[model samples]
Target: MLEIIGVGVALIIAVFLVLAARQPDVCHIARSIFVAAPPERVFPLVDDLRAMNEWNPFAKQPSVRNVYSGPERGVGAADDFSGDAGSGSGRIEIVESIEPAKVALALRMDRPMKCSNRVEFTIAPQNGGSLVTWDMKGRQPFIGKLFSLVMKPEKMVGGAFERGLADLKTLVETAREEAAQ
Candidate 1:
């Protein structure tokens, strides 16, 4: 009976390894939200890494420590973060900033794992508001592919992206309302 159980577990492990090996070497995940404010109003919030704390779900964690460097709102800006187990440690730098239209970042994560990725935010006018899309893409090594098989990067990170966008929407709209008062 014990032997049979061992064989069953081994089979399951083999199947998982096979699936992981079959996964793509590259992965991409994107999520978007429509903020009730114009692109001009929403652009600065994302362009400034320090201001990102106002809307980034991960930045809100009590255990996370964030450090900002370089210019406040454009290329050369960067942020380094270290936090609890759930938060990990990473550095994000703005490599491209297109003012009210797009911002692109290079992200390097260490601690829980070492990986590099690119993130971008594009803001476009739509229906009197702004449509903001957040995208992340990266190269997945064998280890990363295996981890994705278990964690499913899209569902894991994509959920965070969705929440961040919601927070951004609320932050922009609330600020706009307050300014009008």
Candidate 2:
């Protein structure tokens, strides 16, 4: 009986490994939203790491504690976070910024998993407002690939990206309205 159970477990592990090996080496997740505010109006909110706390859904979690380092905005700016499972722990640094248009970040996650990823935000003028896109991309190691077999990276992280963009839209549009009054 014990031998049978051992063989069952081994078979399951083999299946999981095979599936993981079939997954793509690189993973990417992206979500976008349209805000009823111009790119200039929406740029500052994403450009400054400190300002992210105001609209970033992840930062709103009660267990998440954030600390800022480097400049207030532009390259060298970073935010370090420590939190519960819901928020995880990571350090995000602004490695590139292109004013009212693009911002790219280097993300290093420590807790839950140790991996480095790239995050990007692009703001473009559209219909008098702005079209904003949030993107994350990274190379998945064997362990990460195995995890992806259980939880697709796109579905797992894309939802949060969508919610974050929604929150950003509301915040920016509301501010735009208030400013016009």
Assess each prediction's global lDDT (C-alpha) against the native: 0.93, 0.91
Q: Which ten residues in a row have the lowest lDDT in candidate 2?
A: 49-58
Residue 150 miss distance in model 1 (angstroms):
1.8
lDDT for each residue of candidate 1 in 6-82, tens digit (9 for 90 to 100):
99999999999999999999989999999989999999998999898888988889999988999988999999999
For candidate 1, which ten residues in a row score worst on lDDT? 52-61
Question: Model 2, which residues run further than 4 Å from truth?
Answer: none
Best by TM-score: 2
Instruction: Give the poorly placed runs of model 1, Cα more than 4 Å off.
Output: 1-7
Q: Which residue pairs show collisions in model 1?
A: none
lDDT of 2 by residue, 20-72 (tens): 99998988999999998889988898989888778787888999999999999
Which of the numbered candidates is closest to the native, going by highest lDDT?
Answer: 1
Q: Candidate 2: global Cα-lDDT?
A: 0.91
